[model samples]
Target: MSEKKFTKIDCKELKLGMRFSAPVFFDDGENMFLGEEKAVKNYHINAIQRWKIDYLLTYGHLVTDGKTAAPDSIYMLEDLEEVEEA
Candidate 1:
């Protein structure tokens, strides 16, 4: 299988058809998988804006291996630690 790449995009830039590479979460670490793969939809976009989510990870292509590819960044690790501590 080919490696998938994720790009960090501001929530404001999100649009329909962009597949989420990872589950989105609230500040309290609540998963926002409203649907399969958390596929972006009109309501999802509105909800994201209403929740004030500034950024999200998405990929233009799908992963056939059924594994989500996380973005490559140190900030992600820090975020994970914070979530674990919460």
Candidate 2:
């Protein structure tokens, strides 16, 4: 990554399940596999003046019987790494 900008995620544009990757770990240490973007607005509002994460990413899909659920709100800082074309 070449100095990519960390922009705030728009809750409205965000859907229930979307995939994203970051560099930091979520609150839960053991469960670092992935997380979703559940309740974006609630997460955003509650995140202010707290942990202070610049950006957020949806881990993956939520296990549901039929009804769709929002992703996890655990926002982790993503370190940009530059990959050269081979």
Tens digit of lDDT per residue, candidate 1, span 1-86? Answer: 99545555666776665554365444333344333344456677788888777875444333245544344354358779999999
- lDDT, model 2, position 30: 31
- Pairs that collide in candidate 1 are none
- Reference-based lDDT, each prediction: 0.55, 0.37
Q: Tens-digit lDDT track for model 2 on 1-86?
A: 67433334443444444334432223333323233323334444355326554444333332344544333422221212222322
- After superposition, the stretches of candidate 1 with alpha carbons farther than 4 Å from their true spots are 1-8, 27-30, 33-36, 57-86
Backbone clashes for every candidate come to: 0, 9
CA RMSD of each candidate after superposition: 12.4, 13.0
Per-prediction TM-score: 0.41, 0.24
Query: Ten consecutive residues with minimal summed lDDT in candidate 1?
Result: 27-36
